[model samples]
Target: MKSTVEQLSPTRVKLNVEVPFEELSGDFDRAYQALAQQIRVPGFRPGKAPAKIIEARVGRQAILEQVVNDALPAKYSQALAESETNAISQPEIEVGDLVYGEPLTFSAVVDIRPEITLPDFATVSVEVDPIEISEADVEDQLEELRQRFGTLTAVERGVAEGDFVTLDLSATVDGEPVEDAATEGLSHEVGNGELIEGLDEAVTGLKAGETATFTTTLVAGEHADSEAEVTVTVQSVKVRELPEVDDEFAQLASEFDTADELREDLRRQVSDSKKYEQAGAIRDAVLESLLESVEFPLPEKVVEDEVEATQHQLVHALGHDDEQINRFLEAQGKTREEWDAEAKDEAEKSVRTQLLLDAVADEAETEVGQDELTQQIIMQAQRYGMPPQEFIQQLQNANQIGALYADVRRNKALAGVIGEVTVKDTNGDVIDTATFFGGNDDAEAEAEGDDA
Candidate 1:
């Protein structure tokens, strides 16, 4: 057996392989065994017929066809391994010749990972927003806490912003009632804008038992993208009565005994949250800088597949309705052509980023330990609202464990580069990334144990 590779392009290769007849004996035996189990013979039991007898019964052409079909995958894999090509897509194979006692020849064309010239990480620099927690920020958090402890009191006046209302909602398209669009005694908050569009404006200034009708476009169901007249009738209105922000309230809301202590704790929490936001912004900036400095050709098929997948998800989310898709694009202030172009651009960027990070991971020799992988799995499970074991099983069923491993390696690779890059805040101060992303061995060991 022998193989040779031809470079078709920077991101693609063609392989030519030839296997002598003597090398295919194992394949031939397997093929014969498979056929013997299905074909009946006068003197032989099931799966007991000799190869020569099965071949004689099935004819040489049939036997050869089975052998070729059974052998292609293994042969292709061998050729790929020998050629050292990192194929990123399925190969297009063509058999050239197959004759008894002669060499079997075939050729395969596949997409390969492109060679990338990485930029120097030391030269990369990015500016991020300064971490600042103002008094207003702490106050906002305190207000949210207060709202959580607030009591709802029934009000007799017309509905107002921040007031909760019980209402009946019904909609009609072209004067025909939409069954799924009708509901009775639904609770909604005025000015929340969480329900149908124009609902807040329609319900405002309406007292109990008063109805207001307005026209808005339906976003889902069979009538999606169609204009509908929605009627909202308010049954009752109630306002939230927040507890006073004093030392007594502080004790009830938190472990702190005084309002001043509670405010200080909230400020610290806000500062910690801002640090995380700053770190994220820095990471994005660094990646963007790296991408802008590097130039490489992407595998066209990979980009196309990514773009197709993105479009498929978008369409599926829109319920596979073309009209709804158009309406969504319009609502987003984009045309169909513009949206397509953006999707392709984004897909290309995504592919490039993955390839770049993978190369970085290889260069940095990033290792993803079992503990790290488990942590990633747990985090992803939480994001998807699935149990850890269930998520792990689903990943195994889908054969995505390798993907997760690669993701962890790529993340570690990026983290490894953060030390080499310069990061500054908007106030012209050199930010200390170590404050947020510093590696703590003890913490990691504890986390690993917890995960285990």
Candidate 2:
């Protein structure tokens, strides 16, 4: 077999292959043997029919078709390997100029991954929000602690901002009930925006017999964008009376003997949590900035394939016409082409991140302790409402070795990066996990977005 390659584009190639008479004759004989075994010729025994006799018995076209089906694949593959091409998509094959008992000529076109020049990575820098644990933050955390220990009591008066209400609710779209409508004895806080939009306003002054209806779009699963009318009635109202932040209350709530000790512990926990949040933000910023700094061409077919897969998964998970998906991708600043390109780049980045992290883990000789994995698995199982032993068994049964390995590598990589970065608070003070990542920053994020 002899092959020649032509570069069509960075992502595509054409291969011209010529197989001489010797190999062609052998393939033809094999094809005849296969055909003879499948279909018995009149007087010739099965698997013993001569090639020329089989060709005459079965039409010439049938023999040629059988030979083409059996031999074309191997011939095309040989052409690809010899021409040094790794196709991203199936090839288009065509018979070229040919001669009997001579070289069988054919050509194939295929898509391949384009060569890329990765930009310098080490010099890149990203600006992240500084971790700042303030006195107000500690106070806020202390208040949350007090609330968690608070008791709920039924109230005879009107529903107020901090009051929790048990309500019967039903929502409809256009005039029809939205899938399995009514909710019974649902406990919702009057001021909490956990329910549908305009719900708080409707529940604010309503009594057991009173009902109010308002409009809002659905937010989850299907019917996400459909305008719906939500009817809410307060079946009952209750207010949580938080215990006084005193020494006695602290002793009742926690192991701490005094309110001061409890507050101190809460402050320490909040500070530690904030540190993790800040570190995560820094990591996200760094990766995003790295992506922005790099400019390179990717294989078109790979990008397209990634795009199709992403879209299919998105549609399957979020429903076919999920406008939020479009909005989400749009918010990420992507057009179809841009998103396709980004998807393929994201695949590369993911693989590279894992590879680099694994290498770093090897260099540092890092490991995930059995106890740590056990704790993680236990926490995840509890979070997902599954039995811990069952979840662990499921993980093993499903062969999630790669997932566990990835989790370990990711933690090691982040820890490794943290070691290099000089983490600091907003006032240029040294920051640690004990002071930066635990706040309800998700609320702050939304508020910040609304303000923007």
Candidate 3:
């Protein structure tokens, strides 16, 4: 077998493949065996008919058609491997006329990964916000901690922000009571805004045993996106009294024995959190910078397929009901046209990023270790709220473990590039990416030793 590639475009190609008649021996044997089982002959058990007899019964033309159909997939795969073509979309195949003794010839047109020119890593630069922890930040964290240890006390007044209230809710749309819209003894915070829109404002300033009515849009169930008149009856109101911030309170809340020591610890925690945020910003900024510096044509089919897949996932999650999907969009204040446009834009960006990272991985020869793969699996599982073992099994069942492996390789490639690029904070201080990117550790150590 031999294959030749015809470059149709930067992102597409045509593969012309030819196989000699001698190579059809194995294909003919398998095809005959399959046909024998399907085509019954008198005085012979199933799959026991002679190949020549079956061919005669089915006609030589039929036999050749079956053989070509059975061999095209393997032949196409082999052609791709030999030609080193990275096909991103399914092929459109056409086969030429086949004579009994002539070679098999076919051609496949496919979308492929485009050739990308990578920018020099050392020339890329990005700026991120500096990590800043102020006194107010530390105090805010301490206040949240104190709230965790707070005690709720019955208040003999109107509901207010931060007040916990017990209430009963009922709603009606067009004077008809909505199904599953009535509940009693529901506990909610006055200003949380978690239950539904307009609930907080309706209940605010309302005293215990008082009721207030307001209009709100239902966000879920059959009545989603419908405006309903909701009546909320406040059963009781209570205020949370936080513990005093003192040495005794510090011992009660945390292991630290002094308030000053706890404040210092809280400051450190806030600083670490800010540093994490800064690192994420740096990574995104550097990626955006590279995206701007590099230019390449993307495979159109790849982008279109990604966009379709994203929409399909949403439709599947909504139980394949178009009405429910539209209601969901309405609740989010988005039109179907806007959603489609946004999906397409996002898909294009995602495809571009994937292509860029894949090229980087190949150029750098990035390697993903077992530990790195496991760590990535664990992180993804946590994001999806699944156990690592269960997530691995699911990935295997879907045959998506290779996709996860590719993700890890791409991440490592980007991390290596980030380490080489110039990254600075908005304050104009050079940021050490080694700590976060896990690259250039030995080099940093050597520099430290030299300084010593």
Candidate 4:
């Protein structure tokens, strides 16, 4: 058996393999065994017929066909291993005619990972928004806390902004009632704008027991993307009455003993939240800088697969309903062609980023520990509102655990570069990335050892 590789392009390769007749004994044995089970012969039980007898009964041509079919996959894999090709996509295999007592020849064309020239990390620079906590930010937090402890008082006036209302809703399209669009005893905030379009405006200025009718386009259900007349009846309107920000109110609402102390704590909380946002912004800016500095050929097949996967997810959510998909596109003001083009562009960017990070991980010799992988899994489980154990089980069932491992590695690789690059805030202050990236793991481990 022998194999050689041909560089078809920067991102693709072709492998030519030849397996002599002597190397195919295993393939022949398996094929004969399979054929023996399917063919009946005189004076022999099922699967008991000799290879020669079975071949004679089925004809040499049939035996050879079975052997070729059974041999291709293993031969292709062996060729890949021997040639050390980094295939990123499935191969398109072509087999030549089999001559008796001659070596079997075949060729496979596949997309390969492209060589990338990584930029110097120390030269990369980015700027992010500075973390600034304002008086208004603290006051906003205080207001939210007060609202949580506020009481809802029954109001004898019309619905107004900041008022909570309990209502009943129903809708009809062309005088035909939309069954799924009717609900009773629904609670809504007047200015929230979370429900149907024009709901807030139509319900405002309407007192209890008054009904207002407005038109809206249905986004889901039987008449999706169609205009429907919606009627909302205000059952009751109530306003929230918040307590004054005094020492007594502070004691009642929080653990703090004074209103000033409570306000100070709220200010600290706001600062911490802003710091988190700034960290995220810095990470994004750094990644953008890296992407702008690097250039490499992307595998077209990989990008196509990503786009197809995105489409599959949407189709699965809609239960394979193309009409619902079209309605969704209409609601977003996008044509099918435009949406497809956008998907392709997004896929290209995504693939490029993954390849870049993968190369970085390779160059850095990044390793993911058990604890880091577990932490990532727990974080993902929390985001999806599932138990960690259940999420792990699902990942194992879907065989996505490896993909998750790669994702974590890629993330760590990107984070590892943060300490080497220069990051500054918009206020011209140098940013300390160690505060967010957790610093070098080796240094931390050394410190722990010293403490021990």
Candidate 5:
């Protein structure tokens, strides 16, 4: 067999291959023999029919077509290997030059991985808003904990935020009950907007057992496009009763003797969480910088595929219909054309970042130790609200163990990259990495603004 590869673009190519008759002769003979065994001619036992006889019965072209159909994949694959071509998806095939005692010729158009010089990742630096933990942050978190442990007591009072209210609700579309819509004795906090829009406003002033009705279009969610007439009846009113912030409350809530100690501990937890978030943000910034530094022609199909996946994930996140999602996408400044144009770039960036991180991992000899991997799996299981061994069993059952392993390995690689990069705060000041660095940018900003 002889092969030639023609580059149509950075990510695509056309492979031309021809197999000589001598190579195809064996495949054709086997096909003819299979046909001979399947059909017996008069005066001959099964499988004893001559090749000429089979060809005469089935026609030469028919046998050749069958042989080519069976053998083309192997021939193309061999051609790809010999020519060092990597195809991403199935090839578009075309046939040519069909004749006796000659080469079998065909061409395949395929998508290929893009070839480019990787960007200099070592020099990439990113500035992050400082990971700062403050007294107010600790206090705010303590407040949340107090609220969680607080008691909800029945109240003959008006509706207010942070108060849970039990209500019965019903909705209709076009004066008819929506296909599967009704609610009874639903408990919702006044500020939680999980129920249909305007339900809280309509039910707000209602006394116990009092009812009110209103109409509104659902926000962009699973039922965004529809409008419903909702009637909400207040079944009960209740107010949360939080225990006083004191040493006794601290002892009951956690391993602390004083409220001050509990607040300090919660501050540490929030700070650690903030550090994790900041690390992620910094990684993203470095990756974006690295990607921007590189210049290469991207593969169109790869980009299109990535863009499609991104769009699908977005729609899945919205949990909405395609029309509503398109509107949301439009709001994000993404048109069909722009999405298509940007798809390849995004895919290339993702691949490049992974490759760069892997290189760093190699240089640092980073590995997810067995103990760490096991602990990671356990943590993931806890996140899923499942037992560790059961989660591992489920992963193995679903053939996702390899994926889990990959995730652990990739995280180790990213950690190596993070270690090498010097991160600065948004103000160009070096961050005090040793300090108990925890801060919420939004809340901190609000506090700073208040002081101003």
Candidate 6:
């Protein structure tokens, strides 16, 4: 067997493979054995027919086809390994002349990872928003906490902002009632706008037993993207009465005993949250900078697959209803053309990022330990609301453990280079990347042991 590679482009290659008749002996044996089990002979029991008799009955073409089908995958894999090509897409195979007693020849065109020249990490600089928590921020948190513990009191007055209302809603399109759009005794916040558009304004200032009619486009279901007349009848109105901010209130809302202490704790929490946001921003900025610094051609099929998969998921999430998709796009203020363009751009960028990070991992000699892979699986499981063991089993079933390993390797590679890059805050203060992004060997070991 012999194989040679032809570079078709920066991101694609063609492989020419030739196998002598002697080299295909094993394939032939397996093909003949398989055929013996399926074909019946008068004098022989099932699966007991000789290869020569079966070949004479089934014809040489049948055996050759079976041999080609059985040998193509393994031979292609061997060829790829010999050529040292990292293919990203399935190969397009073409068979050549296949005369008896001659060599079996074939060619495969596949997409491969392009070579990328990475820039000096130390030369990259990115500025992120400074972490700042103010009194207003703490107050906002406190307000939300207060709202959670607030009591609702029935009010005889008309509905207003911040008021809760129980109402019956019905919609009609072209004088025909929409059953799915009708509901009774639905509880809603007057100004929340969690429901349909123009609902907040239509429901405001309506007293008990009063009805208000408004027009808005339906956002989901069969009638989505169509304008309808919505009638909302207020059954009752209630106002939220917030508890006074005092020591007693603090004790009820939190473990803290005093309002001042609770406020201080809230401030710390807000500051920590801001730090996380800043860290995320820094990561995004660094990745964008890295992408801009490198240039490489992306596999066209890979990008197309990514885009198609993403679009399919988006549409599926909308129940595969065209009207629902239109309404969603309208809400996002995007047209179909604009969305397609954006999806393609995003897909290209995603492919480029993955390829670049993979190269970086190779250059840095990044290795994903068993513990790190397990930790990643655990984290992803938590995000999907599944047990770690169950998620691991699912990954194994889907043969995606390699994907998880690659993700961890890429993340570690990025972390290894983050400290080399210069990071500063918007206020020009040099930030400590190691403090936030660096890995703690001791902590990681302890966590891994706990997980085990």
Q: Please, what is the whole-model Cα lDDT of each candidate in the order they appear?
A: 0.90, 0.71, 0.91, 0.91, 0.76, 0.90
Candidate 5 lDDT, 315-409, residue by residue in tens: 78767567766777676789867865676567767655544554455555666778978999989999999999999999899899876775777
TM-scores for every candidate against the unseen true structure: 0.91, 0.59, 0.89, 0.89, 0.73, 0.91
The window of 10 residues in a row where model 2 has the poorest summed lDDT is: 433-442
Candidate 3's displacement at residue 335, Å, is: 3.9
Q: On residues 1-452, what C-alpha lDDT tens digit does candidate 2 reach at each position?
A: 89988998877888988887688677787787778798777787789878778777887766665666678899898887777786767788888644455567888888775554433434544455675678898889878878898889887776778788898888887788876657888988777687777888877776666788888877654566678899887888888888899999889988999988988898888878876777787667654554455444455555566556666887777566557668666667777678767777776665445444544455556677778678888888999899999998889998885577657666655554444444444566654532333323434688999999
Candidate 4, residues 18-68, lDDT tens digits: the string is: 999999888888888888888899999999999889868888877787788
Model 6: which residue pairs collide? none
Residue-pair clashes per candidate: 0, 14, 0, 0, 5, 0
What shift in Å separates residue 24 of candidate 2 from its native position after superposition? 8.8
Query: What are the clashing pairs of model 5?
Result: 132-438, 132-439, 133-438, 303-343, 303-344
For model 1, what is the alpha-carbon lDDT of residue 227? 100
Using lDDT as the measure, name the better of candidate 1 and candidate 3.
3
On residues 131-188, what C-alpha lDDT tens digit does candidate 6 reach at each position?
A: 8878899999999999999999999887899899998999999999999999999999
Model 6: per-residue Cα lDDT at residue 418: 82
Order the candidates by lDDT, highest first: 3, 4, 6, 1, 5, 2
Identify the candidate with maximal TM-score. Answer: 1
Provide the lowest-lDDT 10-residue window in model 3.
435-444
Alpha-carbon lDDT of model 1: 0.90
lDDT of 5: 0.76
**Cα RMSD, model 5:** 9.4
Quote the positional error of residue 376 for candidate 5 in Å: 8.1
Model 1 pairs in collision: none
Candidate 2 global lDDT: 0.71
Supply candidate 3's per-residue lDDT for 258. Answer: 100
**Model 6: residue 324 alpha-carbon error in angstroms:** 5.9
